[model samples]
Target: MALNFEPELPTFVFERTYTNDHQFLFAFPNEKKMPNARQIQLRRLYDIMNLSVQRNDLPRARRAWSILARCKEINWKAMWRLGITLLGNDARVMESNPRKIDYLRTMLLQLPEERERILAELVQHYILAGKYRDALDELEFYLPSFPYRDNPVLHVYAGLLCIFVAQPPESAGVNEVEETAFDSNSLSRAQIFLEHAKALDPHNIVASEFLHKLHSISQGPASISFASHDSEDETHTKGCQPSQPKRKRSNS
Candidate 1:
């Protein structure tokens, strides 16, 4: 009995190697490997882009952004805001390069969530560039949609642009009949937009003021100066969202 009391020694012992890579039996092939060199580079580039933007180093940010945009793994649609900022941040550059507007227009389609906001910015840019017709066209194109249909500010913008375009040209060669017809159509469109704006936002002073101007125009020959209302519109836009700061005023 005493001789049989010796316990049998275990043949094998389980020990985990701390340095060994552990792979789960059900892990996917992609999950088992570390990030590829390209992935790491792309991640670094994103960091660079953000850092450069914060520092106001637009050129550097743009460089990084360009590279990142070309990467197949990067989702440019979600990154549209960054692209817009890079392309439109510099007032002089934007003014000199009309291509920036085209870029913004293209990017507008890619971002559904931010489409309304981006469209607003695009319209403002067009106004600043003295492209009143283009701005009105853009507003017309989008304002018929669901959320855009309800945007009071956009309606106001459209209304203002319409009034501006409706002004009779100083050129004497212009046919009176055609000019009258054009003005009539434009003023009608402007009236509708301004009324829609007022209906949407009863407290929108811009719409109220413009509507008054429209009424005066109908009574007699009246001059409604859009230049004076630019600052007012911008002020209201800023007040609408106190948390979000508006873009810098372009020197151009």
Candidate 2:
């Protein structure tokens, strides 16, 4: 008798193609199959890099770096994952691998096509590295672009990075007045980003979650010390709340 059970479908169709035997798994024919294969390799590369970090295996990490460098074309998502892998817990490895990061960034940014996509990945890299200002600058650079403006994820990321910018500076003797002003500015910017993201896609849970955090943080004693810059005329002045559309009642 045949078994009557069926497996659950993968959340992502292409993610199913990846396996531990990455080399053989991705050896498919033609460029059409390359996208899926490349995505698999990117994930595998992160594992390889993590292993390298755990074992302090420089040669293995180098091998992964070489493979990434040799890739003919890579998407923004892969680039973002690879950059995070490069910035893993291994401080020694990160210091030694600066060239790899530089190479990847240059390769991605220099590409004539999909500059916005590459810029988005770069923002991810900067954020992961705790370079919040750099991440914000990158987002601002692309903000005017229609593609960036249309993407909800970019807004979410910008808002997240802006929160980092609001963090208290590590330096001593930071004037309370100046710090408060900076915090207010950063929070306002973050609110705008999250609000825009919610407006664009009401169903985005990430944006919703960030908005909640923004509200919580805003009310916290630390954030309360900062002056509010919200305008009186705006309906959603607080910026934590998304405007809800009116529902029509119908006869049953």
Candidate 3:
């Protein structure tokens, strides 16, 4: 069966962006003149976006997106908010149809100049692409004195993504054959998780709970036993013992 990547028909007016929009309310002198116009417009946009998403109809989505891009209203804020809603909505979609997600990603990035907004979407993109490594790389980037306010959601998503991505393949489904590839700098990761947990909630008990969990891992447990130097050499020799060495592929 073909994928229905587009969002369900959007009742754009009913979406909080238009429903609770003070600007849309105040745009007209008579509040009730456009009583439900917001709802109708919202529904129209939703349907279009939904159709585009489900069908991977980039052309259609891009056309609808173009309208949002040029919006010069005082409350351009709602547009960005709508974009954010897509992030949450499409998280699982990205995981399944990573390439198709590029349609929204390219548009969102182009239209949004705010670092926080861009980073939030970027994090979602990487998560959808199953490129946790890149997502981890982004966390190290600092957004000092950013023009746009920081989003707590980014912190939360980053923490969850880090935990899910950093696990060993055997546990995380990355690769038992490449368990040796898991970086030894996992202590640093533990630190990141705790920090995000803290940022997500300073007084909350869960941050402390996760921090404690990370602390235990960083300290190194007695349960995990490393091989001796002699054993390491023995394993290395066994790896080279194959009758023929496989040729490495070069990406030419």
The clash numbers for all candidates, in the given order, read 0, 0, 14
Q: For residues 193-216, could you state the per-residue lDDT of candidate 3 as single tens digits?
A: 557557656874544654565555
Taking the tens digit of each residue's C-alpha lDDT, what string does model 1 give over 127-153? Answer: 556565667777887788778999999
**lDDT score of model 2?**
0.56
User: Which number leads on lDDT?
Assistant: 1
- Per-residue CA lDDT of model 2 for 1-252, tens digit only, reads 976543332234234555544343232223344345455655556456456755767567756665655544433334444454554445354332344346546756566465567666666555445455655666766665667798887887777666655655435254653344346787889889989999999998877876886787766625432223232111111222122232333333
Instruction: Sort every candidate by TM-score, greatest first.
Output: 1, 2, 3
Alpha carbon deviation, residue 244, candidate 3 (Å)? 28
Q: Each model's TM-score, in the order given?
A: 0.62, 0.49, 0.44
Local distance difference test, each candidate: 0.64, 0.56, 0.45
Order of models, best lDDT first: 1, 2, 3
Worst 10 residues of 1 by lDDT: 237-246
Stretches of model 1 off by over 4 angstroms after superposition: 1-44, 54-56, 70-74, 88-96, 170-182, 230-252
Question: Which residue pairs in model 1 clash with each other?
Answer: none
Best by TM-score: 1
Stretches off by above 4 angstroms in model 2 are 1-25, 29-97, 110-117, 170-182, 216-252
